[model samples]
Target: MSSTDPDVDHALAYPEPPASPLWHRQGAKARPLTDAQKQRNCELLLLAQHKPRTHRRAEKPACSPT
Candidate 1:
């Protein structure tokens, strides 16, 4: 029962500490994108979504060019 005992009981020890906070306490603000940046982002996103993907394979080994 002593605090400084060499073998303390399991139940008497303090429970594990709570997890640390993940997010910042201060308020977050959203910034508007510039017109040029917005246009570029839109074009990039459209290109990514509409990209053409082709899988080409040769029947046999490719011949070396002369």
Candidate 2:
């Protein structure tokens, strides 16, 4: 089989970088965080900690004993 198929090459191409999150931009700035910003950051941290992907467990299969 040929290793240079256009479809395969397209699929293998490097993906675009993910967009920066809100905190990333804030971190880049030198200004101190405000009270509201601190609260927002805390909320974001809590959300990230408990987000579905982070907290989800492997779903159990339904019982099917014969």
Candidate 3:
């Protein structure tokens, strides 16, 4: 019944900020995307448009892996 239970706050624990696929600093600035790169990225975007989104249908049993 307490909020401290893992089941109660697991989603909030150590939550990290969303990452941007663009404008990240770790990698060298993507050298101006080549024509090939632009084509590939556009194709990938189109391919991804057809996949269904995933979602947990049942409660994700708590994991204790450490």
Query: Which segments of candidate 3 are over 4 A away from where they belong?
Result: 1-29, 52-66
Q: Provide backbone clash counts, one per model.
A: 0, 0, 0
Sort the candidates on lDDT, descending order.
1, 2, 3
Best by TM-score: 1
| lDDT agreement with native, every candidate | 0.56, 0.56, 0.55
Residue 37, candidate 3: Cα error in Å is 0.4
Q: Could you tell me the lDDT of residue 59 within candidate 1? A: 37
Report the Cα RMSD per candidate.
Answer: 16.8, 15.8, 18.9
Kindly list the per-residue Cα lDDT of model 2 for residues 1-66, writing each as its tens digit: 376655443553578878778546544558788877776666555555653646543344232222
Q: Cα deviation in Å at residue 63, candidate 2?
A: 41
Candidate 1 vs. true structure, TM-score: 0.36
Residue 48 deviation, candidate 3, in Å?
Answer: 0.1
What shift in Å separates residue 55 of candidate 1 from its native position after superposition?
A: 14
lDDT of 1 at 28: 70
